[model samples]
Target: MIDYTKWDEYYDGGFADEEPINNFNEEYDERSELEKLEYGGQKTNVTAKQIMQETGTTAISEKFLYRNGVVIILLDYSKGIFDKWKNGRILHCLGDRTYTTQQNTNGLSIIDRTLFNADSIDKIIVRAFWKDETKKYRLVNGLLVLSKEKPYTIEENGKYRWVFPLSLMSKYNFQMPEKYSYFLDIKSVKEAALINADKEDGVRLTTLNKLARFSSSKNDIHYKRTPQKKIKYTSVQEKIERSSKIAENALILADFKCEINNDHFTFIRKNQNVPYTEAHHLVPLAYSDLFNYSLDVEENIISLCSTCHNQIHYGKDSESLIKKLYANRKELLKEAGIVLSEQELLEMYNNS
Candidate 1:
């Protein structure tokens, strides 16, 4: 077992000079030589269940589902997580059954005990299973954030079963896929790359897209650029623009809704035979030069109706509007490795 307490040390400079303790057999391992990954951090083959069990969290019912390495915890108690949802945040506990320190053998809450000993279990998966139906979700920062004005719910047991808000899911594209394994595991950037490029894993597109973006953002890659014999400086500035493919995909994913206000396009374009909402890049394309990663991906783009769209770029209170939109997209942008703070983004616009 890995001593996760020292994860930060290993994650930094400590493991750079060391070799992996275990080796995969050549014939049995199907991965090519290049695909064989070397980690500059501690690794263990331990499963998520084993990790959870070690922390004194066990399966209360078979409803606890594990798929592809992701564990889905179902909160069925009367005063479950639903009670903790407040002020746009859910106070998520580590274990299903809440107990006092005296009741628990470890003399600490499940989260306290686990986090005291280990780093953390990066993502938390939750879902609903009732009346022969299931609904799924992965927490946004392991907590649900409600919209300020809209109190949305699909009441179950006279309360909301869908603890995570639908607007959030739509904004972040967290809709549960029709067919998904209880477990989700993507170990390396290569795996993430493969998943992102794959087209046939039913409901894989959105889920894998998110996973891939998160994975790619965290991993290091060797960037190669072709050599240019000479460089020229031009007085004319190139137009900072989003890729047509990315814009088109963003519009399609949004289903023509104005993400900023949750309003629909008032009119349909005759030629396209579809509602028309312009794609607005959350991190504006004009600032493209400041970022290393592509700023033209779907995650960075939002669909808006003509009114909201025009107001965003021109209204006197556009800064406030931009800040509001930034709040909606901050998490998504962070997942994709864009880190421009609200103030920094505002400054760019103000200076311009």
Candidate 2:
């Protein structure tokens, strides 16, 4: 029997275990033609049609598809590998099947020609799928620059792969289905990439102010109340992207007034003509990896005047302000899957 728990072993061993294959094949063989085309093992072109339909892209190769000057590569997820040197996640697509001891030269040539020589292709969209603990497939989509480096070659059979190093461009990593579905809209992926690029290039405060108007209202905000699954740490700057929309909502819910003191005065902005309180993460986003849940949610964001915001970051006696903020939002934070004591929160600031 294949031990699903030991994915590392199963993957490294070339999936030689017979029981799971027999089981999977048996279940797969009974499905309708449409279902078979829609979902299957890595060898199957399962999501190709879905991608083409969603993006109006044409397949330049079996794995490389082209649409409007962009290349979208569909990859089957291997184990998560974090490259400390790159400070990002490295995801790969298994090259081709191996027969006996020899690698397929034809397969290697095709991949090389398709990807390596594509000078015109500046951006590549990567859509990867991995099965979760429940055996349901989850999807992670990101936009990346085409790497100039050659594909990594492995001595292990069936392990020759093309790897893409990815930087975190969005607040959320994987998109979970509302129902048991594997489809991710292509449009949403592109939009998110543009937003992240803008955030990286534009002024931080200006970007937030522009997006604040589009943020969801207090009544419309909802929390999953469950711990968010962590992606392989893929940040280029070691900083996770914060959701401007969530921060904006927090500011809106606070009536654009300082949570530290409602009487605190700040000049109104010309853009929105509201009080210019800054949205500060009370627990700080730098300590996100320590928690099971996300720190980017509305409940974790506090509206503070410029002075108070600066105080939390620079003042010697900021602990009292943190204590008051924590006390006010502890229950709400708990509901949003963030649980930390006042001392721990204070320590986060101190350490930073």
Q: Which residue pairs in candidate 2 collide?
A: none
Q: With candidate 1 superimposed using the best TM-score fit, by how many Å does residue 220's alpha carbon deviate from the native?
A: 28
For residue 184, model 2's alpha carbon misses the true position, in angstroms, by 35
The C-alpha stretches of model 1 lying farther than 4 A from their native spots are 1-242
TM-score of each: 0.34, 0.40
Q: Model 2: per-residue lDDT, tens digit, 1-352?
A: 4343443332222234332222322332332221211112111123556556555777765445666544555442344321111312233444433233343345444433344333222333444433333223334333332333444544554444433333222223223222233221222234445455435423445567665563456677655455565445456433333466667778888888899999998998767667788878786655565567777777888999989988987798888999899899988887877765555666556555
Q: Give the TM-score of candidate 2.
A: 0.40
Model 1, residue 55: C-alpha shift (Å): 32
What is candidate 1's local distance difference test score? 0.41
RMSD to true structure for each model, in Å = 20.7, 20.4
Identify the runs in model 2 with alpha carbons over 4 angstroms from their true place: 1-206, 214-216, 222-242
lDDT of each: 0.41, 0.52
TM-score of 1: 0.34
